[model samples]
Target chain A: MSFPKRIIKEAERIVSDPVPGIIAKPHEDNLRFFDVIIDGPEGSPFEGGHFKLELFLPEEYPMMAPKVRFLTKVYHPNIDKVGRICLDVLKNNWSPALQIRTVLLSIQSLLESPNPDDPLANDVAEAWKEDSSKAIATAKEWTNKYAK
Target chain B: MDSDISTGFTTDQSFDAFEDDGYDDLDTNSVVSVVAEEPLSYEVPYTSLSHEQLKQRFVSSVNQIQNLCGLSHEVAELLLIHNKFNIEWLGERYLDNPARTLQSIGLDLKYADYSFAPRLLPAPPNFLCAICCDDATYPVTFALPCGHRYCASCFKTYLRMRVSEGDIRLNCCLNSECRFPITDSVYKLLLSPSDYNRYRDQLIKLYVNCLPYLKWCIYPDCTYAVECKVNQADLDHIIPTVECNDGHKFCFGCSNEEHAPCICRLFAKWNKKCADDSETANWINVHTKGCPKCQATIEKNGGCNHMLCRKCGHEWCWVCSGPWSEHGTAYYNCSRYDEKSGQEARDQQAKSKASLERYLHYYNRYANHLESARLDKKLYLRTQKKMTDLQNSTSMTWIEVQYLANASDVLQHCRRTLMWTYAFAFYLERNNNTHIFENNQQDLELAVEKLSEMFERNTSELATKRLELLDMTSYVSTRRSLLLKDTQLGLLEGRWKYNLSN
Candidate 1:
């Protein structure tokens, strides 16, 4: 049940100097699993939205990437309904040098630029590619209704 | 061999190079050049080497490549692997563009300064590994040529994880942005002797599997490779039979046990048929005759013609299966045709009996020839002993009596071909071509039996008898080859003219 020295330091660093719009904290019961909240970047359709995420460090930890998933509702092509985000660094492009701070920042930036090409939500991606204004309007309305 | 052609294959090997260059385009040219400019003195398809010899070859090649290229053994291995262990190809590529070739295999020759041997990195005052986030100022640190530094423990953990996953073939630095791969020197420095040995073994296997010319000896736990002279393209129309150093013979084309004269496809199909339980089903239909009185199937295990049905307690003759009372009265009219039986019963009985007879005819021959071949293998030992005896008793030297060994080889080859012919005959129907094939097979069978008899009657007249044995061996070999050629032609030309009506 003892956490690695690296994980403890990362948790301490994140608490002392948290990112401006992102919040990530390990649960008291489980040090490996962290509860995260990301505020959508400004000027995007999901500007005011609050998105929740869950991140867990597996046994292999730095050698392997963390298991990350969205826990809150968001209207975006890259983020599926079940909250799986299609980010490169989270999968095959992962490097042991990357820490939790960098990962959360990547997710926060992913909200700003929803890569419709590498979309997890096919229907959302189609709508966005076909008509951007309409998709953005739907995204803003959903953010207001559910993520407010 | 209709035509002989050879060209230096520098350009033809570009597809493999293109893959190394990370190009998506597939080079689809089928240009395979077999260099037979200087014909080999005597081409023996297989030469078995011991396991120690095989390892020596590997280590020596690794050392030679490492020295010639001024690179580490691991980098030379990657180059050799990329070139399919064709040392000449790797040399050409290396000579053409040394740095580019090294880079292609993920080695940065510029950074790897072989002029100065690598030394342990001096522990900086407060250097923390990004992975563990520990201030490993006191612990040993490994700084790769790529300038990425990590604590000794962290690097060891990462390497162990990769090695265990069988993903150590091309492991890279732990830096998020660094593109440099972890070299063999690092592994040798970090790992214990046992773990390093495991790593080396995996690396060797990776190199071995990439080469098309090399194949592992199929014998269980034997670590020898059968290196063929012909490349994959040359094997498109030819079946290469290879013998391992362990005396295990196999068809290199299909990696199956050696089956000559029969094409690889047919041999695989025939082997599948023999291994399955379908033969038992065929035996049931052919061997067990149902009782006429009770209709209960009966398998007569003994040579007795009288079969008594246990279910009905009715005894009858096996051939016609008539009542025991009818068979006992003087002349045994049970063998005679009886028109009183129902037409349906008579037809069914005739059909089963005919099919069973056909099956028995083929199976018996196949089983007999197979047994003969097995026995001949033991005879080979005796043949060796006899050859020594003849050499000692007569005024002849060992070289003069080498005909005995040659005869033994031809006899064994003929027996093997005869054994497969019976398998070939089983699937074939009674057609004109099949009849011709059967005639050829019979010709071989007679020659083989005659040779077997001659070999059995070992006479004291060594000189004349040895010549006779040599002639008989050649005669049997020719007959076997003719039968094999006929069967091979039929298989290749799709001459399956078996009548469905039968």
Candidate 2:
């Protein structure tokens, strides 16, 4: 298990009753660790392709946030190609009041509503922001070529 | 709202100053008025007297009489009752010796009653919390003749807990002001059936009924306050049942003036703020619903998401208006100077029209996006709470952790160099002060290229990490639950307990 008991516990409930665009399953050996999938929100450039995600609990557990990274190579305003996130909970703004379940749901929301205004991958964000159609096309093409 | 006879006498508030004056002795025939009417305001002269002589006349002491009767204790009193001359000249002429004088009048009056001296009467005893005073704690009760209040459990405990725990002597616990304990005689006054019943009623109304409870503001700020619930009865003017030192009072209804501000109006104002913020965001859609370049609000707009900004004379895709302009046969007027050729002036007007449309489109979406984002943030916080709670009961664990070492480092390196990239966008996107790339053209290009390369390389790797994180979160709870249960069972089944002995 790569996750704390607290995070793994919440993930179980979410998986059993998955949200509309969110899906998940355990990684290889560690029950604590797991792989998740998210279909881009409808009306988004990432639509139709299944995007992958990685999640696990840290040693500090509930007091800290879980580690979440994107697995799909698709371009997004918030996520860099390397799958790193620019979410608030993952950085300086993390509060002890947050947990894994809230964090993942927040990430799912990020996909549905990417903030190109605060870009993580500047070029992809630029492409997305300046010419959304081209960005959407690139996102869809990447989804087909890699996510499948 | 029944009979609105607000005479202020209803509670602590009095109707007017006409009250509490000499209303009790309205008729002048009473002897009590002789003294009460003219209070000697301590400015009168005094004849020196030996303390011994004054004590002999009082039978107790002159000092006691001076202190109790509101006479200045520092001055020696002159005994003038022996031979009174003028009405105002003799202090003793008014001072009647109740035992001797009232007896000669054939009125059977006890000195204790007639003298108006401060006598230790068997005051009605009551009980309350020793700790919180008026708020009685059970078990430590004591009572008075009024039988109004008694710390029943605590009184007994006071007797028992006395020797070792705290102060041995226990006093009355009604209000902090009442400190006399109930003696045997005082207890009887409490035993009086009618008085005891009356006391209990008073206790409930005075203390129990006016107690504090949970209260929170309904405003967006949602500040919480703690005060007696009865105080909120006139919610519009949150007049506390009791006033504090500083004369600040509030009306609960409007959270304003003590009694006047209308809460209904305040609520309406609060509602308007909420409504205004919402429509403001929605309004943006009307202004910039389409792509600035091609005027495509949704995908079904036209030939492609490509278009040219003929007004500003900038060219780009209609879908997003990216900086890289596509070469096209588009032409428009440019109005750049105060004095220019006729052809140039015409170009300016045409170009202005096109730029204006693009600007309006971009502006609308930009504004709309912000309002929606604010609303979304609010909703997210609310929903996030529910999901976090769900994780606890379901099968979630916070044991394992996955690293984004490779991916984060790549993004981090790119972040260090984005300043120049933004400069390029700034320069390309604006005409004057907002130009970033123009200020550092060469550096902007290099930074953009470098950052783009890092992003392109990291995309696939980051994708894997994102998937890993998602999957870990998905089933982590179920797996955690089983493990936790197993560990608990193992401990109960002589594993941890058995090992502890060693």
Candidate 3:
């Protein structure tokens, strides 16, 4: 399917905005690769440090969800150490009407309140499932140590 | 023939004999006399309870009926029937009274029970009241959903404050989410005979028939005190359920919209003409409400969840769909405080504060100097006047004695002189206080005079220089008054300046 103009415009906007928790930057002057940051929301264990992720908009945008993956090595239910995201919007739950802006926003919310019931990274998912406190502390320490 | 005559028929043979004797011409008075001569009456009429005595217990349950006559005819008849069927000796009580017209029933007083209505008091008996220690006749009875009755003033104030405060979620007047508000109509029913008597003493009293207009919304979802104009026809009572708060009566209908006939028999006919025909009606069952921005068709799905753009591709949450992701579909993003912007604002404030402090310092320096110079000029004039007064001698006191020994009230003069020196010292400190250097010499001389006077021993040297400056100052002033060229006494001020080393 052909890429919608609105989708391209939205992708451009997300990159331009230096969001606090999430940083979105273009890959080598192209609209395709966006390196974004997701600071955990306040009052949560993931708060204070940036969590970097990659946003690769497909040629056929809006009609298909963006290819969002984590760049930073992290312990989370949804994201693996190799920058793979396990969100429905990025996977089988992808809808044709969804756009790049919405995809990034949903990822930010996921980082704020991670759901471990459906695991993307099995080990991290299991730890999150078994002991949520240890998982949150580890995630926060990783943010301070790596994502300065 | 004799038996027929016993019944006042005089008999058949007697009639034949009369016809033979021409008795057809007998007088009417003689006929009454013949009938009256027949002996005593035997039929005794039955009696029933008097209308007034029995009516005392009957009160119409219907509001309109009781308002018109003291008692409902239906209830009155039931009272009469009860007396006839259940109580004995009621009939004889008022057998001769005109008001005992017929029984409450239009039957012979004996059969009144068959035709009489059940005697019902206007308000149900159990709807008395739950709040008071004793019912106290419940001056302000308010019916609630649990069929419990509470003081009307108590509940009305609570609900009014709650509604006005926009506590729509607190739908129940009893402060329970499960309980619905009592209906105004049922509240009126709670207005028993004794309630009217007590209504006068309440803190917040309700007027007659005003309770219905005091309609709390019928929407179990929203029992708000709806303004009649705004509510249109959606007004309801405080309690939506029955066996009202008092647990006395149950409204047979009106629980939900599905129940077409409500328990109160109070129903509203909704005309869905506006929304029914429109394709995009907001309220699924009612009329259409268009989108605010585009005037496009709008519809609310079962939940406040889904969104579809009819025109602008603008999908949003029904709750507060105000630009979540600019053009995104999810309502997850927040209106970030953008601390970076706050940092910029704080930086601006700090910069202004630094500049303002510098400005205030400049004003403080200049303000001090201006005040000092003004006071010094006044002190210079007063010293010249004192020198002139000392020169004049009117009394016979010797000059040597005035100058030495007892001296002219030296203690008092010393005190006044010390005060003047202190004032001069204050001015000198003030003038030298500023960073500017042009006024330093005058300030130093003034300081020397002020400090030198405080030490009376060996102060002779400072005092000799002070007297020298004073004589030079007076010479300049007198010469100026004499129209002579100005003398150079300003140089003496430079010479008398204090040496910091000393």
* Candidate whose DockQ is highest: 1
Error of 2 at B336 (Å): 58
Q: What TM-score would every model get versus the actual structure?
A: 0.58, 0.23, 0.22
Query: How far out, in Å, is residue B213 in model 1?
Result: 0.6
Q: List DockQ for all candidates.
A: 0.55, 0.01, 0.01
Candidate 1 lDDT, tens digit per residue, B53-79?
A: 556667777777777777666677656
TM-score of model number 2: 0.23
By lDDT, the better pick of 1 and 3 is 1
Give the per-residue lDDT of model 3 (tens digit) for B273-354. Answer: 1124321221222223344356566666565433556787665443333333443544443343343533553455455555
Q: Per-residue lDDT for B288 in model 2?
A: 35
Model 3: residue B429 alpha-carbon error in angstroms: 99
Which tens-of-lDDT digit does each residue in B179-238 have in candidate 2? 333332332233345544443233222221122331222234422232333333433322
- How high is each candidate's interface RMSD, in Å? 1.2, 20.3, 27.9
Model 3: CAPRI class:
incorrect
Native-referenced TM-scores of chain A, all candidate models = 0.96, 0.82, 0.83
User: lDDT for each of the candidates?
Assistant: 0.70, 0.40, 0.39
Two-chain complex of model 2, DockQ on C-alpha atoms against the true structure? 0.01
